[model samples]
Target: MSAALQIGLVLFPKVTQLDFTGPLQVFSSVPGAKVHLIWKRIEPVASDSVLTLTPTTTFADCPQLDVICVPGGFGTDDMVNDAEMLDFLRQQAKAAKYVTSVCTGSLVLGAAGLLKGYRATTHWSAMDMLAPYGATPAKTRVCVDRNRITGGGVTAGIDFALTLVSILVDRPTAEMIQLRLEYNPVPPFNSGSPDTAPPEILALMQERIAPARQRRSEANGRAAARLGGDVAAG
Candidate 1:
């Protein structure tokens, strides 16, 4: 029998619930897939929403995984310069078959020095922040550059997971999972992307998120500087 596919998702405080759960739902459908919610400690971690997730394994206890994924939210601000978290990701990426992230989770990967020279994507508001980490940012729902795969935003996690499923298993298997989940999305409005949203609405959103974006940008700058310093020190 083939070995079970081990997959781990890093769970951190204030993570966007959908960014983790959307991919979780899709990955759980794969036969013989062992999915783990991983954190520094095996405790309850709160999401940006009301949802609270419990880690199945602590970083110290988790087995080497075939896939390692990070899900993002405002919590990424805390992680971008976190030495322990970045070290853990660096350790895992050494042997993991794929290193992936959803939303601002790419920022965490970038902070870990993993996204250097790779093309990646993140939530639209944070797209410009990728370059400081030596990453080429793509404004797409899902992006794959070599072994790094990234999702654009919270809802994009489903698309990202399904895409990864196709690569890990097969297109037919991913299709079957999509069918079972009734994954067809037909929103009541065509305002999902900045390009599709009405100009005024887009402007309003940009204004509303400006403060958070600025804060994250500052964090990214510090993280990138730290990574550069580490490289120089080595």
Candidate 2:
């Protein structure tokens, strides 16, 4: 029999745990598929301010992977600007069968010169940052540009992962996993996002997230200058 498909999940401090865990659960449901916690080193790292997770592999020790998944959070602002981190992503993604991301993870890919001329999406609040990275920032929750797949916001990771399962294995398998996980979503409030949120709530969210956004935007500018490529958002 063939070896199990190896999937690597990138980890960094301050990353939204849900962005990693949501897709991790769905991917783990598949048969003969392995998921590894990847990071710059082997250690436990905390989420943007929430939970902590231990990484299984580092840049130098990890084996070749079939898929590489990047998750986003405030930490992405850091990763997107790290020359070493982005270079690693570019190398692994170039050889991987698929490269995927959730939330602002697409921004990391862009920094790696992977999203050129590819339509992609990220958290709506962070979409504007994509332009400088040479990607056409899309508004959709899920966007697939060739082998690169990206999702918007933290919750969108679930949907994107199910889609990936369908693409990599089979639709039947994907559906079965979805059923097993009870993937249905129900928001307590009518305002999970800017459009659905009341004006006051939207303003509040923006106010709260602005500092991180500013950092990400600055990192994007630095990355763009380093990469020297055209922005493609279509």
Candidate 3:
């Protein structure tokens, strides 16, 4: 490889590790690629589960990235109003070749003012939140409107990463990487999406997530106000 492609994945408490790890594996597998786990400080960050990961770079020393990926989970509700974190994302996205997110990470991107006027997707539950950021919400597995690429839900990270690999390199390279990862999908249950899931299950999930959704709404309202967007719709 003639030149290295620098990739950064933002790390925070309660983030879904798979969202970052899935893409990290794909990018790191590419020759001449430098993948970074980034945070305010270089320390071990715990995920939503017991899984933990250490940041490879701090905000101060991190170099310009070719790709910036923001993953989401329970922490995102807190992060949307975190000034320092949002500023970090805004600054990095300004210089990155591609600004990306997986799941509810799009909300973080929105809070940073990066998703303004971009068509982006997020978890199905929070897809409508994009409106407050002046963004058009796209409800898809993976949505790529210009350089602002976003993925829907948690497991969609792998699919989004593979799609991104094709953009970063070529279709054949992405294909090879997928094959190496043995990325064939054969889910035992066909109820991954809200449309496919049984009504009872969907209702249960919504009930469980309602509190977090309320938190997210409040955070987005603040973020919208900060970014000079219409708070009413947020």
**Best-matching candidate per TM-score:** 1
lDDT computed for candidate 3: 0.90
What's model 3's lDDT at 226? 79
Q: lDDT for every model?
A: 0.94, 0.88, 0.90
| CA error at residue 21 for candidate 1, angstroms | 0.5
Q: Which ten contiguous residues of candidate 3 have the minimum total lDDT?
A: 225-234
Which candidate gets the maximum lDDT versus the true structure? 1
Mind giving the per-residue lDDT tens digits that candidate 1 earns over 1-234? Answer: 199999999999999989989999999999999999999997899999888989999989989999999999999999998888999999999999999999999999999999999999999889998999999999999999988999998999999999999999999999999999999999999999999999999999999998998899999999999999998998
Residue range with the least summed lDDT across 10 consecutive positions in model 2: 225-234
Which residue ranges in model 2 land beyond 4 Å of their true spot?
A: 229-234
Where model 1 places Cα greater than 4 Å from the true spot, the runs are none
Order of the predicted models by lDDT, top scorer first: 1, 3, 2
So what's the TM-score on candidate 3?
A: 0.95
Q: What is the C-alpha RMSD of each candidate to the true structure, in Å?
A: 0.8, 2.9, 2.5
lDDT of 1 at 232: 93
TM-score of 2: 0.94
Q: Write the per-residue lDDT of candidate 2 for residues 1-234, one digit (tens) a residue.
A: 189989989999898999989999998999999889998888889897757899998988877888899999888888987877887887897689998899999989988888878888999988887876668888888898889899999999999999998899999999999999998888799897788899999998899988867877888888787777433341
Please, what are the lDDT tens digits per residue for candidate 3 over residues 5-107?
9998999999998888888888888878999889989888989999988999998888999899999998998898888888888788888999999999999
